[model samples]
Target: MGYQFETEKVVDFILKNSVKKVLIQLPEGLKPYGVGLAKEIEEKAGVTAYVSADPCYGACDLPIQEAEILNVDLIIHYGHSEILKEAQKRIKILYVEAKSNLDIGKVVEKSLPFLKEYRNIGLVATVQHVHKLEEAKKILEKNGKKVFIGSASGLVKYDGQVLGCDCSTAEKIKDKVEVFLYIGGGIFHPLGVFYTTKKPVITVDPYTKKILNIKEIGEKFLKRRNTIIAKFSQAKNVGVLVGLKFGQSNPQLAEKICMKYLKMIRKKELEIILTKLQPNPNPKILLEQYSTPPEIAANLLYMATYSFNDIVGKTVCDLGCGSGRLAIGAAYLGAKEVVGIDLDLAAIQTAKTNSRMVGVKVEWVVGDIEVLTGKFDTVIQNPPFGVKKHGADLKFLRKALSLANTVYSIHKSGEKNRRFIEKTVTKNLCGRITTMVETNLVIPYLFNFHKKPKYRVKVDIYRIVKK
Candidate 1:
């Protein structure tokens, strides 16, 4: 047999523990021998043996609940080593790592020619070939190559052992080794090693007597993955499946997914509400009276409400509020009071009509930012980027800082402009920058100077707090 099932050790464990009943679990490849092992346990150990027909993926996927239902005293998990140290305290589990007994000398010799160009070689193997790593290392050393084996960490029980989800063994010795030689059956382990280390990998399959270089395979896998992600993002509705297995239970991850889905729903509803509002009929070119995009306004309000907790039951003022998109969003997000101030009378009238249409109360004032006076808890604004008018954004920032304790302001994003804004807020305005999020602002073709149907300008939302 190429693999050792270790029937004697299983009998020894059952007898030593005085186990009266036991459950046998094995991987798909080793499942056919499960019945034979169950019979052997009954004959030698004189105990009741039950074999689980369900597929076992790893030691982590133990049939603890099934064993409990059967009232078995112990569980015999084969083909992998221990991963869940906490689960062992709940039940008695004997992990029998069904080690492969195949000689890897011929395969290692086959990989020698491929590794001839490299002097340093990193040796790694799966759990089945972990015990044979030293034997393979000696062969590589005799061929004028220095071999390095990584120390075991986390779920890996032995040095140079690699799991499908973990490649720390390869990562630990990545810098020291020029190339890696993996002795395993499949391409999964070797592909993980190549991606983790980004080093040339030569896989020696002892069963197939084949040697493969996995660089091209890894590249192809990445291309396929990217294509899948691109197609998946275009999906309108998505369903999430949560695993409830002993080792696969992740309540925190599941909760995050649910929260993310709910947030998307809320944003979509808010965007629809904002789109139905009245836009400014007469927009002045010098004031840059471009109405805020409904999607972008919804995102900004959501961030303020959920992420920063600054919107609900707080006094909010939208400076340079063109057609009142930001101010209306703040009110929709449950602000205690909202104020919209704009120099244009037509924009202010549009804002008042829009607020009444949405059934939200907002105090719309037709005035300049410099004339605005009272204190507020939060102020959100999408001021002009000082493109047509110079230093226009600074004027709004200076006035907003004077009126509110916290301000959410949007500005054009660039390295030089960002540095200037940071310096001005900290030094001149006597305020501190709390958060700066980069997002895109869509500019539709509203004016004659506009060249495209729409332009996506990179912008940053600066969350400034008073010192």
Candidate 2:
């Protein structure tokens, strides 16, 4: 009934393909329209249409095998752009971009105050708002602002479409603009600009007619990171943790050695690396466990424990602990007791292997977080973003809160979501946010189902103290 799907174009494409039967793959949000859409295609194009009800992470996850088994001639994948040209060649698939119906004028008006000062400003948006960028640009120009819109690259199929991984459009035009205007919904993609460049980044939310609290929020974000790095600088023994859950994405041996060597260059372990680069004079530990990136996890733990001093000789819990990054890092940093729990046997196995690899003592358990029932000094975790599941991350947060005096958790960043977390922590969990460290979280190429080799999202590290 609404403008989300362009059914006419879909029917036209099916008729042109001369396919007897076609398959339609919709994300969970769009599945309800399956019956109506199929009926429309069948009536208009005279081709039988079937809907794919499987879970889809992104455009990278095509239901090719299912379509092949069903013997469908074409696969109409909705809700994302193409991630790979190679997949297109191997399979008959068409990606349909589901444009939003949000009005552009209000969002443009709301953003003018931020844009009025910067005559030369760069503009970018996610796919939903890419179509309206030109309209936004016109409005800005009418008010004497010079707007620049860049083309999409890699997984971005249209002009100004920014994936979680790529924000090169803003970077490409960085030198030209005084500030960058990102037209999108959340604190997600706009953050890449903030992290990657010196320019001020502002996100114009079409839905809320609001902008991110960049000045107030960004400063708090950076100060926490500086504190964490400072804490690491003063430490006597540093642990470098690695956790790549989906695969053995440890890069090449030489690359791995380079990464290891740079983190204080443990001379005894190196074969011919002559230079020792010690950012800190601490004796570093290179521990391999499937955990969150050490850079993020260590900082998170720092925020939670209030410093390395607090973590030392303290009992800590790591939930959804993939590869024991947090637990081992804590153990290596001086935590007297560290327990790591995860549902994935492979991750637990990887964590145990990494414990032996790093020589840090930790209690590793393979089970759900609910199985444990002991009060802990602190809980450190990096849970799933739960963008798809709505409140999946909260479940982890609730479980950790029940068992710990303080909980350090990683979450996707946005004003609305942060408010929700704050409300939930205070009201539901009976905790208060002591420290907030927000930064861009890098997600490696988990699967080729994406266009880029890697991507990053704006994530928050919160330290919640139980009241």
Report residue 448 deviation for candidate 1 (angstroms). 18
How far in Å is the alpha carbon of 243 misplaced in model 1? Answer: 1.0
Clashing pairs in 1: none
Q: Each candidate: how many clashes?
A: 0, 5
Best-matching candidate per lDDT: 1
Candidate 2 lDDT (Cα, 0 to 1): 0.71
| TM-scores of the models, in the order given | 0.57, 0.48
In order, what is each prediction's RMSD in angstroms?
A: 12.4, 19.0
lDDT of 1 at 217: 89
lDDT by residue (1-467, candidate 2, tens digit) is 43378888887777787778988988665678878888988998898899887876567667777887899888888877777666666567877777877887877778788766679978888777788888888888888988887677766777667766677777778888888888877776677677766678888987777876365466466556655654553354655555332222344654775565366423222211111111111211221121365566655554444343447688889988876767777776668899999777767777787777767898999897889998888888887666555666888999988988877888879999899999999899898776676777666555435588767778887777787
Q: How much is 313 displaced in model 2, in angstroms?
A: 35
For model 2, which pairs clash? 60-449, 165-455, 243-291, 290-322, 290-323
Where model 1 places Cα greater than 4 Å from the true spot, the runs are 260-467
